[model samples]
Target: MKNRSTELREALEEMIAVGTLSPGQHLDETELAARFEVSRTPIREALIQLASMGVVVIRPRRGAIVAELGPQQLVEMFEVMSELEATCGRLAARRMTVEEQQALQAAHQACKEALDSQGPDDYYYRNEAFHEAIYAGSHNQFLIEQARSLYRRLRPYRRLQLRVRNRLSNSYAEHDGVVQAIISGDGDKAAELLREHVMIQGQRFSDLMASLPQLGKQAA
Candidate 1:
């Protein structure tokens, strides 16, 4: 049987991704258990795991809900994500095995091809794969795990922000810079470039919030 905790986690993640369990929205354990056809124990376990990953907040009487990233928190996320991505780039440039380097290159090229296809959605996941390849290439499992955690926490916002005007092409261009720096074995440069690259997602989200003030309301 699939692990109950994993099953619950995946179900909760899907709820968050699909807007059923929106940011700042309260999560009713009973409702979730009913919705997922699972027991409350696994639901609670999954929520606890999501909390550790910063995707949800669990309050004593108030219960758990998707995390609400305030302006300051959003900025902090951008800053932290940038630093983490840059570090991954630096480490990858220094320690990536030959096959890993090739894999990263292939991921980057695939993203490029997706971008050339000219649809926003076409390139989004491909670009994600490119960065993930870099994260793995860093040769630090702990860092990779942390980065993945943060990435998942930010996925809902990232998916929405990506749909903004011509953002896809712009994102592709940023990836180009990151790719060049990494491929050249310039660790510091790759680190700096990747840090800068990840910041664009923050900017896009910020801009979206500025316009859709309601969307910026507490995660719900």
Candidate 2:
């Protein structure tokens, strides 16, 4: 079972991610404690954890507030994320075991099923698993750790991006190409495909920027 602080941290993280708590909004320990039926200690702990994750900022006198990333900062992070994923794809194509390859294929199929029947929210979970499989297939511990860390930090933005028009379908199509390249043992091809698949550019970048305000208004 999870500890009270851990549970609160995850709850708060989800609230922030779904925009029930908007960026730059204050987080009051007393209010959170009352809302979650917990004490101030746990709420403080939760806020501290979020601060460490860059999801919250703890000021000396102003308590805690949700952290905001500028467009340029967001884009830079995505660029790094794309390169990490591309490297993982390249290495996995050369290094994945038969079992790992099968796992990746299974994950891809699960994403397809979710896309067909369950909509973007459900597909997002499967999509995460599909990427995890590739990260593991690379068999590079340091790379995997770095990828997972950045992936977690960028989770909310990634989830939001899928809500863009036709993005879900386009994402799955890109996954198909990536999977094919990796399974065919073509490292260079897989790297290129994965980089393109993960990069946010041109129209996608515009769409994401346009959607940011909507996310802020979601809880209003």
Error of 2 at 151 (Å): 1.3
| Candidate 1, run of 10 with poorest lDDT | 211-220
Error of 1 at 64 (Å): 1.5
Error of 1 at 71 (Å): 0.7
In the range 120-219, model 1's lDDT, one tens digit per residue, is 5567678778889999989899999989888887776665566677877777777777777777788999998888777745456567576343333324
Residue pairs clashing, model 2 = none
**Cα lDDT over the full model 2:** 0.91
Off by over 4 Å in 2: none
Number of clashes recorded per candidate: 6, 0
Please report, as a residue range, the 10-residue window in candidate 2 with the lowest summed lDDT.
211-220
Sequence-dependent TM-score of model 1: 0.85
Encode model 2's per-residue lDDT on 160-184: one tens digit a residue.
Answer: 8988988888999999999999999
